[model samples]
Structures are given as C-alpha cells and as structure tokens.
Target: MNMHSIPGRSDAEGYLFTRRAAWFAYAMTIALMLMDYIDRQVIVSLFPYMKKEWNLSDAQLGSLVSIVSLTVALGALPVALFADRVSRVRSIAAMAAVWSAATLSCMFTRSYGALLAARGMVGLGEAGYGSVGAALIASHFPNRLRGALLAGFFACASVGSVLGVLLGGVIAAKWGWQAAFGVVGIPGLVLAIAYLLVRDYKTVRLTPVLERATESSTNAARHIIKALTRPRTMLWVCIGGAAQLVVVSAVWAWMPSFLNRMHGVAPDQAAKQAALIVLCGALGSVVWGAVADRAGRRRPAGKLYAMALMSVASLGILAYAFGPGAALGGSTQFLIIAAGSFIMTCTVGPVSAIVIDVVHPAVRATGAAVLALFQNLFGLALGPVLAGALSDTFGLQAALTWTPAFALVAAGAFVLAARTYAADMGRAAEAPTETNHLPLGAARA
Candidate 1:
C-alpha cells in the first residue's frame, strides 16, 4: 500500500504540501544528503593513495578529511540563517552544485595544498545542507512520522559513506584515485538539477505579536538568539551529539586504515570490510531512530533515555571490540566491530528532532544549524584529526580503541538533557504558529 494515500496524524493540522508532494521532497532531500556524505567521505578510501603519492603524515591525511567538517562548521550558521529566510529548495540546489563542483575539482588537484583547498570547498557547500534539509523534510511531513523520516534521511549519510568507501577503493584500484572523485561527483550534479522539481512550502511570516520588536536590528538579533539558545535541551543535546560523533566520525574515518594495518588486508578489501560496518551503522540509525520515537510516544523524555542507554552500550561494545577483540581472530573481531557500529548511531535522528521541537517554526533551520555547527566543529572536525594525532603517537588501533570512549560523555549529556526535555517542548508548543506559508510551487506527480 502507498503510505501517502493514508492520512497521517498531522493531516488534520493541514500540512501545506500534499502527502505525495511531501514524499517527493523527502526523497530528493535524502538523495542529496546521500551525495553530500559521499563527496565528503570518498576521500577516506583514497587516503592510502594520497599518502603514498604525497608522502603525507597521518595527521595531514586526517586533515584532508577534517578540513571539510571544519569549513562546514564555520559556514553552517550563516548559510542556515540565509536558508531560513529564503527558499530552502533553491539554497539546497545551489549548495549541491557547489559541493559537486568541488568534488569534481578534486580530480584535477596535483598537490596536497590544492586538494586540501578543494576539500574545504566541499565542506563550504555542505555546511548548512543537513539543517536546511531537515527543516524542509520536517515542514512537509506530518509530525508523527518526523522521527522515522528524519532518521532515514540521515541514515543516507552512512549509506553514502559505505558507497563512497567501496567505490573509492574499487575505482582507485582499477583506474586511479582521481577517477573515484570524477565518478561520484557527476551524480550529484544530475541530482542537483533533478532537485528543482521538489515543491517547497511558502516561507512562514513572523507573527504580529513580536513583529514590531523585531523591526530593530538589535531586537531581531536578540529574538533569534533567544529562539535558538533559550532551550537547555538544545545545549545538552548539541554537546551530546557532538561527543557521540567524535566516536562515530573517528571509527568511520579510520576503519579502513585500521583493517589494513592490523590485519594486513589490502586497501580495496579493507574498504569493503569497512563499508560493511558503515552499512550496519546506517541500518542502526533507522532502527534506533524508530525505536526512540516509539519510546517517546508516551513520555517526552523517553527518546533521550533510550539514546543514553544505547550510547553507553555502544561505548562498551566498541571499546572492547577495538581493544581486546583485536586479540581475537580477524573474522571474530570484524563481527564485534560491526555490532558496535550498529549500536553507535542511535542518536542520529532524535537529536535533530529534539532541536526542532524546542525552537520556533520560523527558525527551525537555524535551530538545526546550531546542532550541525556543534556536530561539525566539535564532532566531525575534531574526530579525524584527534584520532590521527593519536595514531601518530600510539597507533591506529589505540586511536580506535580510545575514541569510542567518548560515547560515555555522550550518554551523560543525553541523560542531563532529558531532565528539561518536557518543559522545553511545552515552551515550543506555545510559540506562534506559521499559518501564512508562501508556496513556491504546486505539487506535481
């Protein structure tokens, strides 16, 4: 049965987009997201090639991966602010074009400096994409399905990472590393063109109650600040989410290298093994996101509670897998690592949903950007470099073993965030509703 044909719980609330239109938008946004991560992560599998060619240090190799997240962190807020006020569809299309172009540019760069600059451009283009895409998906879909939908949306990143790793290794082995960029880069350009067909909701007008106050630049800044930061839930969630990604990003970035060094697996085969772990993480994201939503059905804080437990479980499983499990045979160790990978992505969906739940509808994208800013800067940006530096001193195995411990910090942060979740959600409920959305286009089959 077509789920779009049935009325979702929020249908009575009158979502502006038709169910079919909503699904279409969701599909496009998710596809672009998949491409976003593919371009960002395809470099991981190419690390061996780059290292061999340039004779780069481990930290430098990690920096190539880290630079994208760093630029994304620096750029997410301003891009998201612009996206909130303008057209999400147009902004997303522009972003896709920029990143895809950057990805393609990677093929032509001969020096380390040139490649690093190109990678920075990729991050610049992707900076606000996750937040903006989340806002678009949230607005189009009904409330009840938001968690599952958003979870699936973010899960594409893992899938992309999987494909990126697999393709980069295979393509590099067959042709060269440069060809991997060319191969992955083309699809994003095509998808960017295709994305134009997705319908967008009318920009929501600010309510009259605070309209006069926002007329002043100072007051507008204050209003925006309050909207994004007033929620304690946002603070803790941001920290927790970033901390969790430290674990996730490190594992994802280095798993291929780890397998090669530890088990003496070839680059292409190691990437395939690493890709399996990423695929499991992607599956875990969707599964756990749905589980969080189901747990939250009655209690508002249930999502946080569930995530906290999973965070701790992931920490334990991964710590052991990388540390002691390495002593086990290769097959045994890979199975354990994959299990840990599956459990670690539990918070991917709910964190975004929680951020959206606490902020006004008008600043939903910006709210999500705050989370992205944290995740990108402190989580994704730091993870690879931190692990790389560690690997330089101790070894790749030590870096992987120690990195998963950050999940403990994530668990604690989530537990603290839960305390204020109910109250924060209630406050969000009282914010003025956006009734006058400027429709950009009509829905089409």
Candidate 2:
C-alpha cells in the first residue's frame, strides 16, 4: 500500500496535483498539528489552579508558557535540519510521541519544578514538528493551492487552542486539572503511532547523464545560510511573523485570566468565552488563506501584500478592542475582540507560503525551521512573559492594551517582505545551486 507509488496525481514538475493520498496526508498532518497545539496549550487552563496551589507569581506563570517556546526556538533548527536529512515521517512521529508522553507526565508532577521539567520536554518534542509538517504538506500540493492549504493546516492551532482551553476548563472544573492534561495528551500519542502508516514522497533524483550537468561543489551548510539570510524578503518575513505572533500568543495565553480577573467570570465561563474568540481566529486563518490564494493568482507577491493589509487592519481592530472601547458592554466587546482575533491570524498561511516560495524544495524544511525559530524566540517566547511583567506593573488591562502596538512592527516587516519578494522568488528559481543532488535521506528504502 505504497500510496506515493500511485500515478495520476502529480505534474511533470513533481508537485502533487489532485490526489487521494495527498489529501489523506493533509488530513493526518493537520490533525496531528491540532493535537500538538492542544497538548501545548492545555496547560494554560490549569494556570489558575496551579497558582492557587503553588502560590506562583505572574512571572512564574508566564514562565510556564515562555519556557516551552524558548525550548522550541532552541531546538527548531536542529530538529528541522535533521528531519530534512532523515525521514520526515519518522521524525514527525517521534516528535509527536515525545510531546504526548511529556504531556502525560505532567499529570504526575508534585511541584512547580517537576512541571517545569516536564514542560521543557514537551517543547523539545514539539519544536521541529511545524516546519517538517509544513514542508511535507507543501511538497504534496501545487503552488496554486499552497496558500490555502498551509493556512488551513495552521488554522488547526486556533481550533486546538480553543479546544484545549475549553476542554481544560470543563474537565478541570468537574474532575481535576490533572485530568485535563491526560485527556489532551493521550490522543496525540495515538495519532503519533498512526502517522507511521502514511505514505511519503521520494526525492527526485538525477539520471547519470543529468548528474554530470549538475554542480559538484554543493554545500548544504552554505546553501542554508545563504538562502535563509541574503534574501531581504526572507529575513523580513521571519521577523514580521514573529512580531505579529506576539499579539496572538499573548492573547491565547492570558485571555482566560483576563476574563476571570477583570470580569468576574468563572473558570469554565472564562475559558468558554475565550475559546469563542479563538474560534474566530480559526475561521480567519482559513478564510484569509483562501482569499490570499485567489488574490495570488496573477501576482507572485499578492499574498504578501494581502498579509500586510490584513495585519494593519487587525492592529486597528485590536487597538480599539482593548482600549477606550473597553467600557462597552460585554456583547460589543466580545464582537470587537472576535473581529480582531480573525484579522490577527490572517498572516499564518500567507507568511508560510511566502517562506516556501523563496526557497528551493531541497532546502524548504530548513527554511521553514529557520523562520519558525525566529517566530518562537521573538513572538511566542517573549509575548506572554512581556504581558505577565506588564500585568505585574501596569495591570493586565493596560498590558493587553499595549500589545496591539507590536502589530505595527509586524505590518512594517510585511511591507519590507513585499518589496523584495518577487525578486527573491525569481533568483531562487534561476539559481542552479540546489540542483547538485537530492536532499540527504530523501529517498525511501
């Protein structure tokens, strides 16, 4: 049952066209990503309980989220490069198993230190999964569908985040917070093992005659360094994505507490309402991604332009949602924040698509890993910690009010990404640097 062996699903360029196995991998990868975030985020729901029991400070609470992102940032490049050099399928499965097992271990923690250790393990497991998974999905679909497909893939974060908060709240309330970790952790383990059965594409190889025409001095380290850095577009895209994700990560990490502390909402109700806001983000990821796909039809840079526009729009909505408008009724505030949530996530797909667009397929996983490294380090790793510190000083409301300003920085980076995007794409296509040999470990045994 080698699904990749089946014919009629790919073009001459080796990009997969319409195919059953392609869609199946899409489903499985996206599902695994969903479970990944669920396990990663479910800890947020237990923050209140943990704080009560542990008597932790806001910094310690924020550290729980930051440490995971920090570890993921540290590990992303190495793990992604290893996956590119090894078997992506196996790598992905191993990552899933590690994270799931670590998450399950969270249930046994007797002190804050134990939970911190376990969370770092979860980060190690989750680090390279995104880039490897994105690379696999990109290789299986044509460029035309790249934006929508990747965006849809990333949209699972919203779903996973929402569900994690919702489920964690409900289960923790009825049973206990430990039960919340168990419920989210077990399904990921199942999905990890099941992923081994999925078929993978073989790397395209050169015939003997064609091998002579290819360059002999191809260096992987050189290629990765040159590709990820020189292209002004790639650098800006990575920085911009990190800048924008700060807002998204902070909101996800702290909104439940915002609801509880500011509005007097119960834990279940707070998580439930926060989930609704995040659900809007899920909707935005898919909708904006599809829109970017359609808009990118004739223009190579259309997707990046769309990202910049949407990001600016999001900044305005969020600024309003958290500011003077705070005095509005709950219903109006919810709608405003929901709108911001949708707009805030518009960059997920287009940004990912842009990264793959500017790099050769051979280096795509590493390219993605590099971009994710910045995103996690600057955005996910820092956002919550910054928010928590601000909350400690200025109050949570003011801390959130200022988070939207970072979106301007994100939008500016997107504009910079657009300026050199088309040029970068053209240069990468014309360069023969990556054609010397197929990527290491890309062949099936």
Candidate 3:
C-alpha cells in the first residue's frame, strides 16, 4: 500500500496509513529500536564478567560504557546530515546491518581495545538509526500521533534492556561472556532483514512557498542553521534531554552492578532482576506517551508537565531504591528499583513527542539530530563516567545516591521546556507556506 497517500488530506496531516500498514510500521520500528537497545545494554550486563576477565578497574569499565556514547556523538550530526541528502530508509537499514556486525565482532575481541573498537562501530551504526529512524517516523505518522508512535518506538528500549541483561547474564553464566556477546549480537542480523522487508515511503515534498524560499542559496542554509541553533531546541537538547540521559545512562549502565554489589547476587540473578526493571520501564513508556498525547490535546503544555512528574517520581523511587533503614531487601529491592526505573522511563515517550511537535517538518531530522547529539555527548558520555568516578571516590552506594540528582535537574529543564510550548506552537502555526518543500539539506535554512 502507498502508506503516505491519504485522499483529500493536507500536508499538515501528512501520510495516512492503512491500519495494517500503521501497525506494521510500528512493529518494525519497535523491533529495530529494540535491537538497538539490546546491543547497547548487552555490554553493560557483561561488565562484571569483563572486569574480572580483563582485571580492569572501575575507571576502565566506565570508559567502556562512555566510549560508545562518545563515538555516537562524533557520528550523529554527520549521519543525520547524510540522511537528509539520501534515503532515510536505506540509511537506517544499512545502519542496522553495520551495528549488528559490529556487535557480533565483540564475541571475538580479546582485549579492552578490541572491545572498545567494536562498541564504537556499534555507535556509528546506531547514530544513523537514532536520527534517521525518528525522522522517518515523524514523516510517516500524522502530527497528532507522532508522540505516541515515538513513545512506542522508545518503549522498545525497555524490552531490549531487559532481554540484553537477562539473556546476556544467563548466557554468560552458563557458557561464558563471549557467548553472551554472541547471543545478543547475532539476532540483530535477522532484525536487519526484517527492516529490509518493510516497504519504504517516498520523501514528502514541502509546500511550494517553502520550496521557492529554500531555492535561494543563502536562504536554505540560513534557515537550516537558524532551526538548528534555535534557543528552544538547544535548551531542551542540551539541558533537558541531556540531563535525563545522564541519569538514564548511569542507571542502565551500572544498575546491574549495583544490584550485584548491594544485594550479593550472582551475575545471572542480577541480570534477571535488571531485566525486570527494564520491562517495567518499557511499559511506562507506552503509558506515559498515551497520557501525554491525550493530555497535550487538552492542554498544549501537558507533555512537559508529564515529564516533570515522571522525573519527580523517579527521584523518589531512586531514594527508595537506595534509602537507608529500609526493610526491603533481596527481591523486594529489585522490585522497588524496577518500579522506579519504569516511572522514570515514562517521561521519555512524552519528551520526544513534544520535541517533534515544536519543530518544523523540513528541519525535523536536524532537530532530532541535534537532540541526539546533546543526549549522547552530555547525557551518555558524562553520566556513567561521573557516576563511576564518584563511586570510586565515595562508595558505590553513595555514587548511586547522587545519580537521582540529575533527575531533579531534568525536572527543572522540563518545566522550562513547558515555557516554550505555546511559543513554539505559535511559530509552527505561523511558519511560511513554503517551509515544507525545501530540500533536506536546505532544512536548516
């Protein structure tokens, strides 16, 4: 079916999908996204084993986690720029293959350097997927549904995290760490094929006025740059989402270890427990997205407010997870932590939806890219490394205690984000008629 074709619909409504096509798109996108999370989290679950095998320090372990984020940041803008010029579908499919192969290569790595190289390759592949995938979804789904669909896409992260850790932990326990890498990495190849099987939609042309204005050499570039450099975009990109990522990266990257150390659980058990946490978090993504979308319909700024509440709830949960004199222990601690993780993750769906809502369609990819850049650069790179350092300096428990502080910061950022919603919507409504027809490369202008 021509998924983008909807009779008598305006560009504002974008594509109209058959129910089957929409579900297919959602499923395929979710699967692709799930693999992305699984591959990333697999390494995290294997950290304890990797450390034991390599005789690595906490610092080195932190490097292993941060390296991927560092590489992703390096590649994000370039790949996003490339996506604008090329086929986003093909780019995403190719990325799926590239990262899957890189992940599998980890099974053969003997040293930290080799492992890091493989992880970096994974980052390169993921950068393309992260920026391009979101753009494609934004284009395919109607504006009204974008937040919910994106939320659904991001929800897969929870599933991937759960599977990555639980399965990796199990495989590592029974066979070896290499087996864990192989098991987690190999499935993505199949997923790549599934991605290829999905049909690609043609690029939607922007409105004529945008096309004409963008035809001017200076106009296109200026517009794109202006879009990229917008204060609203930058604020959320750098401070809001990035701060949350810091919290997320640190928690996901190290939570398994925290579980093991605090509760004296085996690696396999810890992995299973962590998986449960991720599963709950994944569910939160869907629930929050729906809530945000519905709420935003009534109150335009409701999405940000939802995020703020999630952040606050996350802080409380983190405290409960680490708080002193609590009666909870063993599986109870795991259950509480899992619940908390889910509540925190709930914010992700709404936050991303709101970001897309505020941007022009032509520059959507750039908006996504800028957000990805900040999220990885500050959120992924700094969060885990800083947490590790703090762990070394104070104690693991103490370091973990500080992790939730970022959530509080994230809450403030979301509140600030709310301030821009009405203004952004107003700008979008008043956007030039020709804004949509501009070439992808001219989007920033």
lDDT of 1 by residue, 305-355 (tens): 999999999989999999999889999999999999998989887898898
Alpha carbon lDDT of residue 398, candidate 1? 90
Evaluated at residue 12, the lDDT of candidate 2 is: 65
Tens-place lDDT per residue, model 3, 210-242, is 554444445544665677555483366347777
**Candidate 2 residues 177-202, lDDT tens each?**
88888888899999999988766655
Per-candidate RMSD, Å: 5.6, 5.4, 5.1
Where is model 1 poorest over a 10-residue stretch in terms of lDDT? 436-445
lDDT of 3 at 208: 59
Ranking by TM-score: 1, 2, 3
User: Which should have the higher TM-score, number 1 or number 2?
Assistant: 1
**TM-score of every model?**
0.82, 0.81, 0.80
**Which rank order by lDDT, best down to worst?**
1, 2, 3
Kindly report which residue stretches of model 3 are placed more than 4 angstroms away from their true locations once superposed.
1-30, 87-90, 131-154, 190-223, 228-238, 290-306, 325-328, 437-445
TM-score of 2: 0.81
Pairs with steric clashes in candidate 1: 202-437, 202-438, 202-439
Please report how far candidate 1 places residue 84 from its true position, in Å.
Answer: 4.8
